[model samples]
Target: MLQAFESAAFAAWPAQQSLDLLGWHLRLDRGYTKRANSANATAQSLPLTASDVQAIENHFRRSGLTPTFRLTSFAPIEDSDRLLDACGYRACDESLVMTRSLAGFVDGSEIAFAPDAAAWLDAFAHASGKRGADQAVHLEILRRITAPCAWAVHASDGPSPACGLGVLVGDQLGLFDVATHRDHQRRGLARMLCGGLLGWGARRGAQTAFLQVVAANSPAIRLYESLGFEIAYRYWYRVPTT
Candidate 1:
């Protein structure tokens, strides 16, 4: 179900804008519960006009939901930030679409899969430090990885201190929800978790791996770069005004 959401989020672009909008709702509603949300809208041409902005804002306002817009940095808009500002929108955070080639990568020792749905949810929430739709979504992901995929955790002195989830998607392995306990930082646990997932991906005939990261996360960016992942695109967020 998590994979379905991700795929739907990606596929909704240029196909089903309303469904795409709902996916954004699921993501933000899960995160903020109610205070904030975002939406991704696109056009075939560049340079959105004031009227275009108003139209989008009206659409959301009529739906009784606040509107926040996300546009790619590569979008052909001149002074997009200014346009958004004029519409009462502000830049939130920048994020990158990163990809890595997985050819010739080798799988390392296997990590044990959690025994049941409850255990998986517990580990995921423990690693993430919270609960809600994100946890529920990951739980669904585990339920779907019944094939050439693996999920696992690693411990320092006791039971695993950090956990990671990964899956083979086509010719690529995708890693998500890699987290370490607050007490486990600076111990290289994140690296170890990620490395294990990369190894798993390689063994499963994946030729590449991809993940999204907030651009402001320097440490993660550095780690991924060191691991041979390169920035493929920059995605930006904006909001529409009523």
Candidate 2:
């Protein structure tokens, strides 16, 4: 699972495009570059320190980039939160890392994976409240998906309902960006899409699959936990001060 997490992080880093390491804290230029995004600090065997945080902040400031930090799988590090508080970095949000073993995932039904980019974007916009310039972010995501990487999307009848994206890395699957249109909620489209992704991962020999969800999203958390996923870790995001 650790290796899989690292692999996913590295794969995502290129999209962010550049990175710098400060002990355990990875600071990315140009809005938290891709390389730094891949740093699974908490997943590492060693612990991170306050100096690491300072180093990353220094690197970001020197690079003339806004200081953004993402702590992945960042469990308790001795005085980690204190360091952030000392450095003027405030907690932005927290997310839960949920994992599920795929030993019993079965391919029960065929869910139509979205093949059209326009349709996928429409669904994304409806679910995420992101439109206009923010929609450009989907282009990078589409590039990754159409690169023929392992991804799946299920649409509803008449129009596309919700969408789920999953990426497979070695023996694990990373599920990301599961969104459902407001009107399409309560119909279990998200579950079907998630189940389909799990099935896809299982077929490819993924023993476990994991995803991150906002800690405040109780519905999503409940769904995942009910599907046999457990909270593996909690991560927080923060931005460094000048």
Candidate 3:
């Protein structure tokens, strides 16, 4: 199940470039998000040796990116993690992969679905406060998605208060970029937007839903838990000290 989510996530949030090396997926996207730019383990059967690590690091360096690794429970990478630690890699940004069955999922209020990717990016920028170069990078990632997706936003008389993305791969739905404007938070906008996204996925035959969030985000974790989501697994990144 963990591996399944990993695959779905890769497709849902794709990188600009990817290469398979020694059971690790080396991804790069102008050093944006770690998930897109880090080396992620995909197979346990292939041994991850110190030389392989050097090769991976060299590849990232050649691409002008910091060598980073996303170690997850999806694959048996305990040895790899230990090797990275020994090599002065600092572990950080622990996150949870939450999931729930959408057998009886319910949605609230009529949330607007963006007519197109460009419109969705505009609303997301307003709600997320991410613009300029970041907006272009995000748009590229969104455009690269081949799976069915829904860009949901909740707006009132003024600018949008919340925006999110839902990507469906087979029977699974992966939620990403769920954000509410700082000024409009605590007004239940995120919950409503998430519910609407889930509904959009459920209606399209998605039987399961998954989302990733930083473990330290108590409020966000609580909100997901309230919606029947549970922590299915944990993942963290390893980056060089210098």
Collision count for each candidate, in order? 2, 3, 0
Residue range 1-242, candidate 1, lDDT tens digits: 22332343342211212433222321232223121244553333345577766665665666555666766654454565678888788676678867788878764644666666567567767776877655664455455454454566874345567887666766666666677788877787778778888887787787778777889989889988988889877776765343
lDDT of 3 by residue, 163-209 (tens): 99999999999999999999989988898888888998888999999
Pairs in clash, predicted candidate 2: 13-34, 16-34, 17-34
Order the numbered candidates by lDDT, best leading: 3, 2, 1
lDDT of 2 by residue, 1-242 (tens): 45455455455323434443533435343442233432335444244476776666566677666555566654444465566667787766688878888986796756666666566667667665667764565555456442223345564456566777766766678787788878768888888888888888898788888887889999999999877789987777665554
Using lDDT as the measure, the top candidate is 3
- lDDT for each of the candidates? 0.61, 0.64, 0.89
Better of 1 and 2 by lDDT: 2
Predicted candidate 1, C-alpha RMSD = 5.7
Give candidate 2's total backbone clashes: 3
